[model samples]
Target: MMNEQLLDSKFETEIFNSQIEMKSLFYNLETEIQSNISNLSDFAFESHTDLKQLIISTNVTLQDNLKALQTDIMQQLQQVTDQNLITQAIITDFKSDILNNLSAIATYMNNNQLSMKNNFSFTNSQITNLNTTMQTNFNQVIADVQNTNMNIKNNFTQTNQKIDTVNAQINAVVTNNQFQTQIDLLKQQIQNISVSVSISQSMTSDQYRCLMIAAWYGSYTARDNYFNSEQYLIYLTDSGCPLLKWW
Candidate 1:
């Protein structure tokens, strides 16, 4: 019976020790679980704060970028507007200059046309006057030619009569030997006078014709004593008459 009691006591003591060990292990496991849950919760909260801060920083950066873009856009638009205004002003000035140049060209053309018309009219009148003067000169030349022809015919008739008389005198002198010397001297003197008169007459006729033509053409300038002077007659007979000097 004592043995059975001892066994029962030992069994009871062992069961009690096992129960205490199990209770201690359960308490350690519960403490470890609670610490793990608290650490996880703290880590989650820290991560959420960091994420919020990052989001705030990103939102601030985006806002700043948006403001900068808006400012840049407005500045570009203003520059474009200013350039457009300057371009428009330049175009307007160019148009005004073009119009002024065209107007000046038109005025110049008009003045040139008027000047041409006046010049043409003056030229026509001058040509008409020249034609009339030429016709008058032609008529005068014709009249002078007719008069000269008549004078030449009369001079030829007189020359023929004088030649006949000289021939008769020469024949009579040959027949009369006493008056032969006197007749020979007279013949020599008459030949010298005839040669002088022929030369003088030719020069005078040419000078008179030239003077008439020059007077008709308004190119003759008469000297103070040219009409009836011995010097004037001498000049007409000479070969070196100073027609240009009188002019």
Candidate 2:
């Protein structure tokens, strides 16, 4: 149950992060468009240009800006799309593995359901082995996700730095406020998510699962008190999923 919840949580996280990346990219594009609008409006107002010439120049500027913005947006969008594809593939694979694990666990449980149900014949050594294997796989998945996130973050950092350099070059000519605040806020949000993800990874283990069960079923009030428990996540089950459970 805990594993299923974790899987669902991870899947949701991937989707959310992908959307966040898309939002950041769109925000950048929006800022660029606003800047262009301001520039063209100012040109129309301040210059003693012929109306025909002004219209032509403004139209050309808009076209060029749109094309450039499209290119930039497409590149960012592709990166995010690719990342999402990879994340989805990973999730699919993990779901299969987890399902197999659950099926095996369920079968074992059902076979011993009547007599010594909880005491089902599995040895401590076998349980330990399964735990070790699960832990190793979990660690590897976390590492892969972390690496992917870091790579994206590094790309974002590099792109932002380049943008800042370009903005500096055109600061005097551009009327916009450089849109630095939005960029900073977006970056901070990503960082916060990264930290939370790392904390989540660190808290997950066999011992933690045991703790989750203890807290989940120990008290009447605590039975559904999944709010503070790490295992209280969205997961899949043999019966049906995505299920939310405290353990």
Candidate 3:
């Protein structure tokens, strides 16, 4: 019976040893699982922090670009306004200069027109005065010519009357009876005197007959002398006879 009791005690000791080894293995496996879970959680948290920092940097860059674009647009608008103001000023000055030049030209034209009108009026007055003076001189010349013609007619009438009276006196002398008797006696005496005297050869026959008649009638002084008186004979010849002088 003592041997049997010893064997039962050995079997029980082995079973207890097996149970202790199994419990040790289970504890080691649980510890390894807990360590792997802690590593995974830390990796996820680190990734989240890096993504948030990248988003904040991109937002800051966008805001700075917008501000720069706004500043450039405002400067362009101010430049356009300044150019428009300069163009308006230049146009205003050109219009004012044109108006001044036109006004000066109009004034010069008016002055020239007034001067031409005055000259035309003076020329007309001078022409009228010249015409009047010419008419007056023409009338006076006509009156002077008429007076000269009247004086010439009066002189012609008086000369004709004197000629008629001289003709009547010559006719009376030719018809007298006493003058006929004296002419016959003078003819006889001239014939006798011519025979003795040397008569001038230059005297024509008609001239000698006229001289004897004038001396016998005593129209000029007859000296009481014969044909021998040289002085008396010379006076009769030099007379050329009064009838020739009258004619």
Please provide, for model 1 over 89-193, each residue's C-alpha lDDT reduced to its tens digit, 9 standing for 90 to 100.
Answer: 655655565566557557755767776576877645654665576566556556655655565566556556655655565455335343333334333433433
Clashes of 2: 4
Candidate 1 minimal-lDDT segment of 10 residues: 217-226
Q: Give one digit per residue, the lDDT tens place, for model 3 in 19-125.
A: 88766755554444334323322332232233234334533544454455455445544544554455445445444544654564466446666754768676456
Clashing pairs in 2: 4-235, 4-236, 5-234, 5-235
Candidate 3, poorest ten consecutive residues by summed lDDT: 220-229
Sorted on TM-score, best first, the list reads 1, 2, 3
Q: Per-residue error at 219 for model 1, in Å?
A: 99
Estimate the lDDT of model 3. 0.46
TM-score of 3: 0.31
* lDDT head-to-head 1 vs 3, winner: 1
Where does candidate 3 stray beyond 4 Å? Answer: 1-37, 97-247
> Scored by CA lDDT, what does every candidate get?
0.50, 0.52, 0.46
Error of 3 at 135 (Å): 65
